[model samples]
Target: MRFKSLKGIQDILPPETYIWQHLEHTSRKVFEKYGYKEIRLPIIESSDVFTRSIGETTDIVEKEMYTFPDKGNRSITLRPEGTAPFVRAFVQHHLYNEPSPQKYYYMGPMFRYERPQAYRYRQFYQIGTEALGTEDPKLDIEVISMLANILKKIGLKKFTTEITSIGCKECRPHYKTALKKALKNKLNDFCEDCNRRYEFNPLRLLDCKVPSCVKARTVAPAIIDFLCAQCTHHFETIKHNLELLNISYVVNPNLVRGLDYYTRTAFEVTSEALGSQKAVAAGGRYDRLVKDFGGPPTPGIGFAIGIERIIPLIKKSIVHDVYPDLFICSLGREASDRGFIMTEQLRNRGLWVEMNYDELSLRSQMRKADRIKAKNVIVLGEDELKKGKILIKDMQNKKETEVALETEEILKAVSNKK
Candidate 1:
């Protein structure tokens, strides 16, 4: 049989990876600015980590997760989403014990067994940030503002922010009761999934994207109306703070997060450029996830950017070519050996460099340099090696300079450009 990548998996090869690198770098910079340090977690986790934290009724547990028995007959799963694993790390490592609010960010692939479409893939990447151990509404505003700032920094400004408060333990039950009551009258009109959601998580029905379910919910009672005094005050304060920051948003009563652990705040950023799969990023506050995962009570909020979705929306010319600072083209046996050592020495000096060891003509080597878009080309011919001098050509400006082949002279010459 011919080998191939799995149906829903694709390689991030070549020029495409330039965009990924830019996105990851931008995310790290932004997250670090907010005091969030990077945390690396295993791609596979004990199945219970998700089942216990993500809830048994959610689609991620029932339908999407890639779970299998391990060598020890223990259930292990490829993480379908980031938050559960992030929380697992927090609780397992006792992060909350170190400080009042533990902040972390991650960038990596997540696996699921779902039908892929548009920007959604079975194996996909995400950039997410989590802030644990705080409940101040200003933090919620900060997260939303950060999302807006990140999208703006990435050149995705033509997007809308949708925000909502789904209430908390004290008040959400009442909203669920009201929503279930209103949905019951029109339950038959919704899709099968809606009916299933009705029986278990009634709040989820409001966020359903199904055409029929969405139409049916037009008459359903809104969750905002059912928010108790405290949640109502909280939502109002969030809106007031958003106004203070001049962050435009629409109050989406149906913006309930897909995760079971989320309480109070939930928000999403969408773009019309992405068509029907409009959401490029989404997240919310999960105030009780720490305690649920065996840690002391902590309040947290975060957001995850769907990297695949963001790639398309990113404007062209934003991700530039990955060009090496120098490419060395050498001819003759002695020149090649000397060129190779010089390549290593230049790299040790922290300059991006590339050199060919093959027996290609100078023209062929230049072609390779052009393919990689090298900024500077160094020509080390037999005579130049014998004379302790080399030829340098700037690919961008079409300028040429000759200098002593010593590392310091070459470094000074190349490093002097604006």
Candidate 2:
């Protein structure tokens, strides 16, 4: 029997990984500019961490999480998302005690058991940021603006920002009742999953992918109609601040996010380039998440971008190649051994170099270098080793010359050309 990887999982092989590296580097630079620090958390956590913070009725808790029992019969789960684990770390590590508003950004894999299509996978990566311990509406505006800036930076031009407020705890119940009444007679026409959502989390019905549910909710009551005085004021302030920053957006009443932790000011960036599953990034304010995780009363707002979705969009829009700087090609056993050392030296100088040490022929090694799109080829033959010099070939210009293999001379040759 041939074994295969589990479905809905993908391996990010070499050539495609260049896109990921670019995205990660850009994300770190933007987050640092906003005064956010990187935080790493466990990929697996106790099951209760998500159930308590993400809400039991949410799809992530009820249907999607990958949970199992350990040797001690305690339930542990591979995290289905990033926010809940970070919140747990925030409280457990006592980060809240040090500052009023702690900003953190994280990028990693999250697991969920769901049908895979297009960019949706059982194990996928996300880039997210969280601002904890602030209730100011300016924080909401900042979070949304940062997300928009990232999308623009990534070269996604034909995208739209859809903004909404799901209302706070005080007024959500009223909207829930109104939403339920609108779907009461037409419940059977919707999918079974949405039928269950009606009883537990009626708001998620707006985000349903089913054609029947979407058509039925066309005239349904929006959450904006039921917002309490405070939530209403906060939503308006977020919009006003967005206007001040010249960020264009459309108010989407039916934009409740999948996670239950979100309280107010939910937003998503969608692109027509990705059909059906159009959302490349989405998030909202979860004001009560910290308190739910046994921390102080801290209000937080943030966003998470689906790396898989964004990478595809970027590939379509951008035209650039990420290639190795140098390819160290060697002949004979002695030259191959010295080639490894030369590769390490070049790498220490912040240059990407590649070489294979299985003692392949000169022609085979050169072919491999070409496949990797190496900019220059450094030939370390027995003759060059004896002379303490090497032949350097500029692959792009098709020029060859002899240069001293010493560190200083090689550095000067490469640096001067650039």
Candidate 3:
């Protein structure tokens, strides 16, 4: 029987894996620089974690989450997003007690049961950060700018940053009422999803991309107009500080995050190069979630960058090639055994070393080394082993340097040449 990978799932193979590593390393560097620590969360959690946090009326809980009952007859789910589980950990561990604003970042797979499109998958990876315990708008600006800096360092161009204030508990109800009143008559013209969203989640109706829904919501009231005095000030502060940082952004009135936990400032970074699945990263503030999850009142903001979405764009901007620093070609069994020991020594000494274990002919081994783009090649045989001397060939320079067969001498030759 021939089995294959499940649908909507993908294997991230190399040189692509190299690109993923590059992205991970770059993100870690940037995140650490901004005083955010890494937090590793599980891929599975109690189903309520998402349903309670993402909202029962939202599309994620209504349709996209992967949920099932465990053997204990308790419902379990593959995490559809990162924030809820992070909040659970935060509350359960009382990380809130540590400092005024506790900042953390996470990177892992997120499961969603939607129809996979280009750059969209059932099991996708996300790099996200959450800063808890403050409602300061400066934190919002810093988060958005940090996201821009990561993309900049990763060599991504041709993207736009969009932001909005969805209003807090103090004023969102008024905006929702006005929106429903405006869209009531036109609800029949919207798609079925939009129609359902209208009754249960009017804010999401504005988020619908269906052409008719999009056109209809244009006539609906903008949430910005309904911002209460406090929310208004918060929005203005975010805008003013972002300008000071020179981070360009557009205030998108219709940009309501898909999650229900979000309140106040919301933002998304999108690339036109990714058609339709344009959002590469998005997030917002969730001021009430900690209290809702049975913890003390706390405020939080975060964003998640889709790894699958940014990889193609990053590839266009950067080419990551993996090559062995040294390839040792062995022509005989005795030479092969010795080459194996040499390879380990060089690797232990902090060099990328490879060797042909299969006792292939000299020409075949050389071909293999060349195919892997090894920087240097050493041909070891009975003659060289007996003579106690070998030649290291520089693949790029096409030059050869003679060195004693001792590991220290080979190390010196390679180190000096490099």
Task: Report the number of the highest-TM-score candidate.
Answer: 3
C-alpha local distance difference test of each model: 0.87, 0.87, 0.91
Off by over 4 Å in 3: 185-192
Q: Where in model 1 is the C-alpha error above 4 Å?
A: 210-212, 366-372, 385-389, 395-399
Kindly give the number of clashing pairs for every candidate: 0, 0, 0
lDDT of 3 at 406: 86
lDDT for 272 in candidate 3 is: 95
C-alpha lDDT of residue 288 in model 3: 97
Query: For model 1, how does the per-residue alpha-carbon lDDT over 198-316 read when each residue is reduced to its tens digit?
Result: 88888777878889888989988777887888788888999999999999999988887767989899999998888878889999999899889888888899889999999987848
Better candidate by TM-score, 1 or 2: 1
What range of 10 consecutive residues in model 3 has the weakest lDDT sum?
314-323
Q: On a 0 to 1 TM-score scale, where does candidate 1 land against the true structure?
A: 0.91
Model 3 has an lDDT value of 0.91
Steric clash pairs (candidate 2): none
| Reference-based TM-score, model 3 | 0.95
